[model samples]
Target chain A: MTFRSTLAALALAAGFAAPALALDAGTYKVGFVTDNTGPLAFAGTSFTRGAELAAEQISGGGYMAVGAKIELVQKEGAGDAARSIQSYNQLIADRNVIATACCILSPIAGAIKPIALNNKVPLVIYGATAPGLPSLPFVYSVTGLPGPAEVAMSKHIAEVAKPKTVAYFVLSDNEAFQGRFKASQAAMEAAGAKTLGVVSVLSADTDFTAAATQAIALKPDLMMVYTTQSPAAGIIAAVRARGWAGLMSANDAISPLAVFKKIGPPLAGVPFPVNFSADASETPKAKGFIEAYTAKFGAAPDLYSAQGYTAIWLIAQGLKSLPGKPSREALATALNKITELEHDVYGGLPMTNGQAGTRYTLFLNWTPDGKIAAWKP
Target chain B: MDLFLAQLLNGCALGALYGLFGIGFGLVFATMGILNAAQGAYASWAAIIAMYAIELAGLPFPLAALAGIAAGGAVAVLVDQLGFEPLRRFGPGNHQAAMLGALITSIAFWIMLDSAAGLMTGQQSLAFPPGSYPATVFQIGPLLLPAMQAVSLLALAVVGGGMHWLNTRTRFGAAMRAVGWDPVAAALGGVNSRVIVVATAGLAGGISGLAGILAGISTANISAGLGQGLMLKGFAAVVVGGYDDIRGTAIAGLLLGVLEVFCAQYLSSSWRDAFAYALLLGFLMLRPRGLFGGGGFTRA
Candidate 1:
């Protein structure tokens, strides 16, 4: 044989020698739909990475129960709702993916939820935190929703700080943040704290001198801010610049330590609650997860990263439970039945209420030095 | 009341940046008789370039600003040569068509630049360290003002003064006005209208770059959408101030900024944007000619 023909034949032989990881004849494919680009691309990248890693590790170690290889298909949602739905439809129709994972944006998740239900495909949402998802037989959230974070934060504030009065500053432009803030405010009021007043700020407003001045004049014991990093940082800087010494707290939207650092030392003692953290050693799983994530991603994983990693692990766990070659119905039932599953990466979270929601969250507060540690409620 | 005044001042500071941006838009409109929609993209490029220099290259802040200004000027000149000049030879009625082309080209350029930036550096807001400039608050009986706002206002003054000097005191300025008034006449009179046009675009771009750098420093963060929203608001300011009236454009920019702040303070923050557009719509309907109306130029 000619040298070229020999090389080609050798390549073919090598390809054939590799394991075929396709699903069984009767099994459908599993599609991982996510945003690989746009505003929330970072979250999507981590989610895809986590899922891909889990699939590879599990398959390599012979973790599948049915001795059938699973096929993983990935699609980019581009962080647009219409495009997400279109991508979902394409994945469902073409790939026949039995299960799917979705994006971080609540609106996009909400839009895709209906499509997943209609197609009867088990949908796993990893990043979205918007509350009040309608009951769908196939849709399940393995990560903590934004509601619990707010609830936990309010309870912590009322129990620990015991502030006489609280002022709420919410970003009125963003509907999701606004809704979460309002709900948290109601919870705080129910806990017997007097609500000073709610102030609305535009997301586009960078300079918060006026808002800070007004907020200080109210003389509330604590200021609860609900906004994203950019605007929230601006508000914190403005308030800190004016030397308003009242206890400052923010929701998950403003939880990143980088934000506090950017706003400078005035935000030293500011408290905020987050769902996950690299230094939350209250749980034994924190150190190991942090080490493994840092080793893999070259940095300590943030809350988003942890949630993303846990999400794929949850999916893999559910996929492992199927008796025979897993089908769409089998995978869905397996996922729905997951309870108190140990996410080796994230300590242990119970997936309660299969299609409705999940109750799993951890409260973390930022210290003066920017380290986020679990606060014992 | 003190809070209201403080917010208004804060708004004015932001408005000054917008005004500088509007001046750049007005300069292009006055000289070329075509609205350059790419003004914002150029500004964003300037900001991104500055950010890249400061964050990635680890250059000092002033050096980064200089690099940004140079890049902005280069981009403006490039757009004029490649995107605008070929279409400039079209008839005066093609002015609208030329603008549409520039708008589409600018939008495309924005997307390309934004994507390229994102791919090169992972997508996240590039936040600068605060206290890069002093955060000293100047208090006047509860109406507190940031020292940075003072710097912003000062920058606006410099831009205004520089533009005035360029337009009135310099021979090149006279030549520019001559070309703007009648390009055919100026070319016939040996004015080199093409050179004037390119120079105008470059100068306007440099000013826009300065605005972007200032904005990046002031806000402490730079992102892909930096220029998109600013472009619309700047255009509105140009329209309100009168496309040909440079001074009016600057004033209108500050006015819009203060108006947005007041609206954010009293009305819901969500309505602040609506209020800005509403003001623009009201102004457009009431005075179609703009605040300073008179068309003195047409592109040849």
Candidate 2:
């Protein structure tokens, strides 16, 4: 035989040969859909990087069986849900994506959830944090919804340091954060914290001066805000610029470091609860994740990255539990039956009704020097 | 009453910025009959470049802003050269078809500019330096305006007034108008029509760049994604002010901004946008030519 023919014959033989372990081994595709290039690009980039690292470690014997190789079928969105639906269908048809990890935005998840469920592919949602979505047969969440933390924060203000009057600046279009506002308001008002007013803002709003003027006119004791990082930075700056400084608070939407960078030295000491923080990564799993993540990405992982890393590991646990040949149907069964997952970036995540939300209890605050630290309050 | 005054001042400042941006959006459409969607992109690129000019180049804030505005004009001319110039010169052999082709090309350029800015900045939100705005507040008793906003209002007056004068009184402006009326006739009249087109593109871009910098300076939450949003509002300003009149377009933008603030203040905040649109729609029904257009609405 010619040398080229001999090489081709050897490659074909190696491809067909199945030795290794009696586990679900050899190239498996996990479809990951994220908003990698848009307004919330930070979330998508961080999540996908962590997932990529998790895939690398799993493929290199970090978690599951060494030979249980996984291929991440990555897809990105630029705030287009139609494109996401199209990509999901394409990936399922061509690549046979066994399971899917989807979305940083709740809107995108709302769009693609029906497709995965109808296809019987186990969908692990990473970012969209609306409540009780895991009630669906094929749906599970690896990231915590903001409900628990929002409720707790509201109660903390009312019971611990109740302010008499409060005003809010909310993202008008985000149904999730708007719901977050209601959850927070119910707790605060139940204890008699009268709401002064609500100033609705769109993601497009650049000037919060008018909104600031209106909010200051109310002269509330506490200024409650629920907006993503960009608008959060804008609102805070506007209010501060207008010389209204009673008290200010916000949800995890404003917790990213980018917010702090945008509005430097303006009340950086405000503490907020988040799912995970690099400073509070004490568990063996979290420590390993930080080390591995930093080594791979050349930077420590943030909350979004932690979400992606833990979520992929959660999917890996399902893959490991499959006793026979791996199929989307079998993986769904394994994940549905999974109540316990070890070494979740959440540190042994306790799944309740196939939903894993609420990471280890950790609150983070920005120091005057702009470093993140554990918040005692 | 004090709260009302505060809202008025705040709205006026914001309205001024919106009006300034609308000048560019309407400038191109009024003169060239081409709705330039990339006007917001010019602004986004200006802000991004200004951020770098401040941080990387170590230039003082005003000089950096000027540099950024200059870059905006340069980019606008380049876009015209690539996207619109070709279509205007050699299109589908009909005026309507060429106009449609140019519109599509402008929209494409708009998306391309947004993507290019996003790529250059790694889709990250970049803010100006900490002391970019003065800490001084322009206050009159209960009414207050930040120094940044005060500066923005002043800029709009100078730039807007200068543009009006140039368009009405200057020879170049007259040539631009002649070109707008009929490019072939203007060329026959010894006006270099293509040069006039390029110059108009630069002016529109510079105006947008100035508006973008002013908007970015206000809250320091600058992002490339902000372009499309601003473009929509700019279009609204153009339509409401009168499509073919720059001064009316500017005033209409101001009115829209003020109306939005008042709606949010007096009406329900969540329903403010709906309220503003409803009011504008009613006004437009009465005055179809817009707030200060050439003719009033009339029934035959």
Candidate 3:
């Protein structure tokens, strides 16, 4: 048999076998679409842990709306846009799933959100904070909007940093990320901080020697890096290689401990914002969540995990509110009515209505030793 | 001035790597008229093999590098025998077809190797731990060179010098030149042109492998596409240096590296790649035959 045919057969077998497992009492079938095996796999894995634990907790009678159980069917999106749409379609059509939770990249989620809406499957985005997502009726974003992170960054810079001049570096490949970062730059400029030029680099670029040298020449008091982990690591190395001693601030795209581990001493005093802290065991809920996640996954949870956990919990809450096996319409209605969701899952991020839509976000900064501490704004 | 000097030094150090790979590319073109696209894949395979030997099997660095070079040479021979020989039998007029075949085979090999490596080890950046080598710095006046960079430069010089000697002084080199100057006449004169061709490929592959190993060591990590970008730069360097001129290829490689560094430092870093291509274009327009264009050979 051909490899393609073999793969197809395997997929069919897995799909058939998925529903054979005994369903828990009152368990409402939910589908999870995620990029579990791609460049963003690390984030996906963490998010999956959150979703899995939430599903387990709901099944174990931790919190139920009325008389419904939750069963999650996980599918790997592999970070491809077309694959995510296919996965979402399959979940909605094949599984007859009422709600879908995803931790796929923004572009993939953005494309799949419309499909979810058309199919009447309530879509909850866990990790991605893409701007246009919250505006969609069927789509509910548990993560904060991209604008809040930028605004919080600007506020922090103005209050604590108070640097005379700041230079901006952003990945040119991602239009959504670049647009949000550009707004932050404009805000920084408006807040009486001199804006040096914005340097655009390719997302896959490794060598930062030239970029770092140019930024050094600018002699900015502060440098803002708006990029993901890989390039951010390279940029930090390049900056340190040139012996630049300015304060460095990064956007939420920067992975706190992961970036710190890769960059080591170069990232000393470099501050970046994150939405959740895995190390935070302050509140009972936070502590319990950490213990349960660690027990299940054998590792600490990050922002992705917290967001994933919150997304599933929110979906479960919606599912609980429904009478008897909840339909997609019921789930969508339930999600729309969700006003203030205070869960220990994400340090009690309040979901409130803003001019655009629901705004749910928090900020955390990284210590030099790579500890993620909550950044109180 | 100090920063400029530092950047210049940095550029030269990086350019040496480009020069090393360009020399291999120029060697094959000068000896055999084939633009071996397989050169880059062979280099990557060699580097990965070396990394595997060192990391997985606990082999010494030197042994691992030797194994890598040997593996590169073997792969080059395999490509010549399987890919080039069949096309060469079709006559020189099918050079375009030959180039396309080589490119496809090389790309196929690269993808297979990359996927296999990625699957074998989970998609994680393979890094050499800190202090794998002594972190000493060599300073001469205002110039500061890291020990790793210095070693890389020194290795390049030795390999480059050895290649120059082999090409100019050796009997094999003379036979290869005779074959290139007139293959029919050289064959009639009983100079084994097939052997010469294979030897040239092997030598080029060995050099490329060494370049890959050095890059891996210096960067402390290796990815699937490590050789792809480097190979493009190497090809550009050869074109800018004059396709068949070995020394010119080396010089062009170093010059290109320095240009990239300067652009990254003085101008916008985002434009570094743009600047590198622009320099190549400007140089090509000024000197169509390349900086030292003398050898009558065409490149793809």
Candidate 4:
């Protein structure tokens, strides 16, 4: 025989003798829809990075079996309703991703969720805190809704500030935040705080002079502000600029370090809730994942990253334990079986009411020197 | 009583800032018979540039403010050259067509400027540097006054008084008024109409920039879209006070600001804009000639 024909014969024999694991190797495609390049760009990118890391770990035989790999499809939603729905459809219809994961803003979730439900695609949601959404079937939230977090935060603030009277300076246009304002107010009132008054302003309002002045006039001991980081910073500065000595409290909307950077010293001493902290987490896998993520991404994981990483790992676990080549429905069933998960970055997270239960939020105060420390309740 | 007095002072300070910005809108409309839709964009750009100067370059606040004003003036000159001037040179034959063309061009410039500033901070507003304004409060009898409010009011008075002088006193002021009344007639009477137009635009833009800085100092936050709200209120002031009446525009602006504040204080802050706009709509319906119209400031 010729040398080339002899080599071909040997390769054929070797292929027949190879392990069956090679033949069983397959890829599960997952789509990620998020506001990656828009207003929520930093958050969306962090979520994407975390998911990517989890996919890498799982497919590379570190977190799961070696033969199966996960292929991630990413799309930018820009947090727009129409755009998010379009991106979801394109990912499902065109890319044929078996499942999808998204993060950050609740408005995007509200927009694309109906589409996911009708199409019977298993959609995983993260970070969106608008309440009344945990009941949706086929739509799983890795992070709990805003109701529990705000309630917890309000109770915490009442304990820390000990204010007799609290006023709300809310951005009326943010539907989610606005919707929670009443519940949060009730929570505070129930916690032995008096409701001073509620001052509402448009989201585009740069000058909060009138609103702040009006609120300050009421002599409230604490101000509960609901707005994005940019405007929240403005409102805080405006309130302080008016020489009001009252304490201020806000929700997680104003919690990111980037927000503190924008707000500078004004944000110091202000308490807000955070969903996760790598340094403070006690989950065994969380420490290892944090080190691995930092080693891979060259930055410590934030709340979004932690949640995103957990979300992908959750999906991977479902895919791994499934009996055979998993269909979308089967994968979703496998995911439903995991009532609680030991997260790599956030310790233990339990699922309830068809979604992750409300996790305990950590309250932190920014120090004068730009460091964050846990608040003593 | 203290609360009421404090709210009153707040309204007045807000009014002064509104008037300062209103002057820019009033100037462009009075001179060219075109709505300067980009007026707010100029204010937004000024705030961004001022923040960059103070934060990144570490310039003193006052110097940074001056730099911002200069940038606003430069942009104003560019807008006049690129937008209004072009429309006038190669405009449609009809007056309505020319006005429409100018409006569209001005709005386009506004969007471009707003988008550019938004890109600088990834669509997030930046806080003014600490000490951009005096955070301390000054007590005057029963009223506790914020130092920034006092400073802003004083600055507005000085600028408004200077604007009044420039419009009614100097030979150049007379020339501008004459041109505003009738460009062809002023040209025939030996007035350099082009110089008047360019000078008016720059002066208006500088005033808008100063308003922007003062607003930023007051709120301690400067968003890229700051100018939009200001522009809306300023336009409303111009329409309510009579387009060419500069003093009337200032007074109207102050009135609107005070009214809005009172609405927020007594009614709902959410309804403040609705009430203010409703009042404007009422004025337009009841008296199209405006509160101070027919004074010949813009009479052809």
* Per-model CA lDDT versus the true structure: 0.72, 0.78, 0.71, 0.77
Weakest ten-residue segment in model 2 chain B by summed lDDT: B291-300
Give the per-residue lDDT digits (tens) of candidate 1, residues A242-309: 76777888765455545555555665666666556666634666666677666776766666666656
* Superposed Cα deviation of residue B237, candidate 2 (Å): 1.8
lDDT of 3 by residue, B1-300 (tens): 766876777777778878888888777777776666657766676777887787678877778889988887887788778777776676446656666766666666656655554453344444333334334666767555667667767876887788767777999878878876767789999999899988988988888877777766555445555566678889888889887667778888889889988875566556778888987888777775788877464445
Q: In candidate 4, which residue ranges exceed 4 Å CA deviation?
A: A1-33, A36-77, A86-93, A101-107, A134-137, A157-162, A171-175, A278-335, A341-344, B295-300
lDDT of 2 by residue, A9-128 (tens): 998886666432235557778998867888778567888898998888888983555567778998776557887787777777754678888877777787788888888888888877
* Interface RMSD for each of the candidates: 2.8, 1.7, 3.4, 2.8
Question: Model 3, residue B2: displacement in angstroms?
Answer: 4.2
Error of 1 at B200 (Å): 2.1
The predicted structure with the larger lDDT, 2 or 3, is 2
| Stretches of model 2 off by over 4 angstroms after superposition | A1-22, A375-377, B275-286, B295-300
**lDDT score of residue B152 within candidate 2:** 76
Pick the lDDT winner.
2
For each candidate, what's the DockQ? Answer: 0.36, 0.57, 0.27, 0.52
**TM per model?**
0.88, 0.92, 0.77, 0.86
List pairs with backbone clashes in candidate 2.
none
Candidate 3 stretches with Cα past 4 Å from truth are A1-105, A117-121, A150-162, A176-199, A252-257, A327-329, A341-344, A352-377, B1-3, B24-95, B134-156, B172-206, B213-221, B262-271, B278-300
Q: Which interface RMSD does candidate 3 score?
A: 3.4
Per-residue alpha-carbon lDDT of candidate 4 for residues B4-78, written as tens digits (9 for 90 to 100):
777778888888888889888788888878788899988888888888898889988889989989888888989
Candidate with more favorable, higher DockQ: 1 or 4: 4
Task: Tell me chain A's TM-score in each of the predictions.
Answer: 0.80, 0.89, 0.85, 0.86
Of the two candidates 1 and 3, the one with more favorable lDDT, higher being better, is 1
